[model samples]
Target chain A: MRIAVQAESFDLGAEANAFAAGVAGAGAVVTFTGVVRDLPEGGLQAMEIEHYPGMTQKAITAIAEEATQRWGLCDLLVIHRYGRLAPGEAIMMVATAAAHRAAAFEAAEFLMDYLKSRAPFWKKEITTAGGDWVAAKDADEAALDRW
Target chain B: MMQVLYFAWVRERIGVPREAVETEAATVADLVADLIAREDRYAAAFADLSALRVALDQELAEFDAPLAGVREVAFFPPMTGG
Candidate 1:
């Protein structure tokens, strides 16, 4: 498993290629990327992501460990960016590999579900009006109940 | 001395990212009460417990969790990561 919490942008194609090439004897690989979305009015300027340094890594690692254990994944990669980002920029990505597509897809979704709420990062949306912290959605917390 | 940290609006409201707190509080709630009694900023930051979350020693924890042997404590709003 590889986990990265960085401020720099990543190349999606490059990352996916690397992950797929690194895995041995995996029949399937699934990748998911999260990108920043512009507000409907389109005045969104930037998104400032804040995170607890030590705890962010710890939390993500714990989540990844649980996913790998639960799904018996062949390999996993998670990269989440922190700091200012313009709308439409890639925010993060997760890739999972397994002998079968079902496990790969399921583990990838599980990782995303946990990362949405459990990770220690917070996002503040900056727009022409001002900046506002993005509120946690009730649906996000509810998403965990299915697993 | 316990290392207490704050994040997001909590840090903004508390006016600091972190501080070393000297306290005898037995639980996370007790420590919060001590902080709330310190000044208006803390009081305002901790006004509503339901909007907040806590981490003890770098792990997510409950407000009522005991602080025994804990070296670090963090208070912040619910995470909105992805």
Candidate 2:
């Protein structure tokens, strides 16, 4: 498994090919990309993300391990962005390679659900009124409950 | 000896982010009470335990739990994490 947390955008095809290279038996690979949106009504201000240096990696690694356990995936990659990100920027990516697409897909979704709820990152939103630290959305917690 | 840390609003109320203290108390609640008795700021900071969350050794944990071999305790609002 490979995990990367960077402020740079990644090439999906490049990552997909790289992940599939060693697959002597696996015939399927899946990739998921999460991009920052530029929706007009999105009401996004400047985004400030904060994280604990060592704990962030520890948490995400655990999340990835969970996905592999549940889905029996061959390999995985988790790439997340930090620092100030504007709308339309690439926020993160999770890619899974497995013998079958079903395992790959399930592992990918599981990783996201766990990350949305458990990772230790806080977002500060700057609106026209002022800046406010974003609270844990009920929807995020709800997302994890489905699993 | 242990170091207690408060973040965000908790820090704002307590006026300091961290403090080191020795305690005869065996649990997190007792430690909180010790801080609360020190100042009105501590009282306000810990006014509602229901509104707060604690992390022992940087992992989310409960306050009613015993504090054995724990070097750090951090308090913050509900994890608004992603």
Best prediction by TM-score: 1
* Residue A70 local lDDT, model 1: 95
lDDT of 2 at B59: 82
Q: Which numbered prediction scores highest in lDDT against the true structure?
A: 1
lDDT per residue for candidate 1 within B1-82, as digits (tens), equals 9999999999999999999999999999999999999899999999999999999999999998999999999999999999
Every model's DockQ: 0.95, 0.48
TM-score of each model, paired residue for residue: 0.98, 0.81
Q: How accurate is candidate 1 locally (lDDT)?
A: 0.96
What does fnat come to for each candidate? Answer: 0.98, 0.44
Q: Candidate 1, residues A1-147: lDDT per residue as tens digits?
A: 999999999999999999999999899999999999988878899999999999999999999999999999999999999999998999999999999999999999999999999999999999888899999999999999999
Model 1 interface root-mean-square deviation: 0.5
What is the C-alpha lDDT profile of model 2 across B1-82, one tens digit per residue?
8988776567668887778988777889998998888779889989999878787877878889889899988887765544
User: What is the per-residue lDDT of model 2 for residues A1-147, given as tens digits with 9 covering 90 to 100?
Assistant: 888877676787788788789555675788878766543666776665555445568879988988878877878888887777776666678888788888888878888878765776666665676656667767877888778
TM match of model 1 to true structure: 0.98
